[model samples]
Target chain A: MTAWQTKLTETFGDACKFETFRDNIRCDVRTERFLEVMKNLRAQGFDLLLDVTGIDYLHYPKAADRYGVVYSLVNTESGERAYIKVRLNDPDPAVPSVYSIWKGCDWMERETYDMFGIVFEGHPDLRRILMPEEFTSFPLRKDYPLRGRGERHNFPTVLRSDG
Target chain B: MPLAPAAQYPIDADETPDHEYLYTLNFGPQHPATHTTLRLILTLDGETIVKAVPDIGYLHSGFEKLGEDLDYNQYVTIVDRMNYISPICNEIAWHHSVEKLMGLELTPRCKYIRTIIAELARISDHLLCVGAAALDLGGITAFLYAFNMREKIYNIFERMAGQRFHPSYTRVGGLMFDVDDGWVSLIRTFIKDEFPKAHTDVARLLNRNKIFIDRTKGVGVLTKEEAINRSASGPVARASGVVRDVRKEEPYLAYKDLDFQVICGTGGDCASRYLVRMGEMNESAKIISQAVENIPSGPINIDVEDKLTVPDKSSTYRSIEGLIQHFELFMWNRRWKPPVNECYGATEAPNGELGFYLVSDGDGKAYRAKTRPPSFIHFSLFPHLIEGHAIGDVPAVLGSLNIIAAELDR
Candidate 1:
């Protein structure tokens, strides 16, 4: 293992599970400390923010605590890629925004906010991105209703009429 | 006193308030340049954009919510709909994520086939990007030329998968169907003869034209640091000198075996981004040629312990195993459950690094499937990119970003 991986494992210990697949190192960090770990990783040269996304786990009790926020980071020069998984529980799922550290997080954070409703604390403009402003629910959430909002405007008939 | 400057007006004068006077322009939801039904409410100051707030969700079909209710195998088709321009990458990324969690090793032949098809999709995506960009730049002639080539690529796709768009040809274990000899030759011919000429023609028509250059050269200048900071991927970042091609960096699906360059440009402006995508298309054509010429002879799919293969209709009557396999593979909740873990897989999508983050709670259905679409992120930077530019430059900047609204609004 490289120095950064070793440092991550030592710092988080049981809270952080480490897996090396292909050429990438994946660290599962506690959601509360996700921002801190990312900051540390950034300091250690994972400068590029490749992607940020949310994963729902309503199916299992183990993951039922909260949604998962996965951040993929890479160092442009070294070509080192790392996947950090942060678990956020349902009631107050919030993580500090890395937008301050990496500007790239601006959009990715908005997307996470849009899909899972996991608010990134300190995001400059946190708004519903993919969905409309009046959209009442987070569409990506497992428990969200898939069909029939009962509003006339929500009906496919309205769309057909417009077409 | 001589007529005081207009600024000396009383606070309660009968004049419109600054906020009310500002024009609220809706750019999309039905507008053609949006690429999809993405709606943006741009508050404009004269012709300059004051604030461009994107009002998306017009095309939100509850794909993620639907994924939760559907089984694993059934979700691949939904992924295809996320980025309609290049559905192959979506299928490949989802399949790869599932395969990773399941610890399934794809056959070498399957991997090669994936590379070929993915490159084809990349070429097709670049065709749309180039054609659409040209159209937005007011080069209707070049746009038509690029679309003409795009039509040929679409015809190839139709012949192979029986659908021009949303083929969903890639399956969990392997391809839904193998490439026949006819399809192989057609693709080979496209890569060798037709593809290069299209690139050349497009370049001749639009690349160095004074008007095209003037409109795009310095517009939407995102620096390398800014591009990376904004999580820009694919050509957007590459055009900014980020050199962050997921294929070259991560080496998923035989990209490691193939020799190709990660096309990069110094200028992070519209012109540089356009050129980078054009260069990438050339590279994609080269990759297709390599794959076609050196493709190995073997079964496209692996035989797993469970009946994971989709059975043919002809064998359903004669073979019980075929019938059972077909039922198991296609039936709801019968898809394989990957171990309880999370995996993130990214592909060098035409737009950018299209990623799929899947969380499996040891269930037949995905616990959570989040898509990291490049278009969404790229479009988010629009407010910053178009701030000082004129309304006329909006189309040029948007075209350069190649923001596919299907991916953005997904």
Candidate 2:
């Protein structure tokens, strides 16, 4: 096992399921223990939080949960990347925020909440980041239509050359 | 070193005991310094900003959603608009991620050509950032000098990929087409003769100018810890002395073989960021020249029978198998399919680490396409940097970050 895998398994024991595919290492942790794993990773030199994005596995039949939050972490010194994932069930599709660990997660978590509707518990300010404040739909959800629900048309056309 | 005249005097200290002393100022949604629709709600005490809340999302076009609807190849056109200043870099980054997911190995010629194009894009991008930052601080001559060099680079792009700005030049398997000797010579001339002169001219005009130095020296300084904690990348993090460049570390495309230096700045200020960008332009020139000189003479794309490689027009017209392959590649129902897996691929974009997180479901189209835009993270640091500094320093810092609005709001 690589140092990252060792570090993960040593920290979380059997709670961490480490897997490598095509040179990318991903560790699966439950939502309850996700924050603890992230804190450990940060302490273990995963200084850069590259990205925090959530995936909706509504169509995957084998998935145990409907939502999966992916945290792409990078150890800048070693140029090694680690991805930590936590699955959230539909009943409570929320996970603890990592804003305290990495300040970069502030907007990233909000964006995830805005798109996937997966709440980041304890996020300082969680709001719709890429959409309007009044917009009620999570446009990135699997059920959401690509053309949108006529909400885009409701806005006024402000610019027209003919006018 | 001294404060601006307005900041030297205090505002209403005790005049309004019942009222809020700090007045709010909406910096943008259409401000010149922002260059795009980025609104910062600032609570100002006279000239110094006490708090800044960046209100973004005006330019969000739901491109990520569109990625799910479009096929692997069809989404390249959409990715071009993410970072308009360096659209080719975005194209390369998107395809690099897609190629990684599909396990596509590019030809050596394609790799070298890609490195050259990407470096040219970087030079143009940094030139624009430095020039515009200088212009934002009342240096128009530097802007013109920088733009003139950028125009030469545009000519090279026009020669290679028919379009100057949105050159959807990169296809899934390889480039749309290959460049000839004329394009190579033009790029060589730009690197050898034109770009350096313009770079020097711009540097001479603003590098030691007292006004420029004073305005930018210590303005919006981000400590190394803050830069790393906030996940700042590219020149922004480098200026803060946090060593991380995807090109140097990740070694994508032809960067592993090419020789170049990673410029760093210790100041962590606007001036430091500016110097880092300027030094990077020089290094980019060096990399481009090296790649151009060592470009291998071979097929630009893989000579494969896969659906990812579009069949040549003559082959499609002459051979029945080519016709069938072409139809199968472009047909609505039957196209290239990806495995049910997810992959994250990133490149050292001019701004920072522009990453693409793709989730495929064994479909022709992506199930989930998430863009990890560096500008989004860089822009998040705006509120932190703008606070406790004079409002005038906003442009200097914003320019240093080079937060492309399209990428930030994508």
- Return the top candidate by DockQ: 2
Runs off by more than 4 Å, candidate 2: A156-163, B1-19
List model 2 lDDT by residue over B261-336, tens digit each: 8899999999999999999999999999899999999988777576677777888899998898888878877777
- What TM-score, to 2 decimals, does candidate 1 have? 0.90
Clashes of 1: 8
The sequence of per-residue lDDT tens digits that candidate 1 reaches over residues B199-292 is: 8998888777999999898998998888877778889888999877778767888888889888999999999998998899889888888888
Residue pairs whose backbone atoms clash in candidate 1 = A56-B368, A65-A89, A66-A88, A66-A89, A103-B229, A104-B229, A104-B230, A104-B231
| DockQ, Cα level, model 1 | 0.58
TM-score of each: 0.90, 0.95
Question: What does the lDDT come to for candidate 2?
Answer: 0.89
lDDT of 2 by residue, A108-151 (tens): 99999999889899999999888999999888888899899999
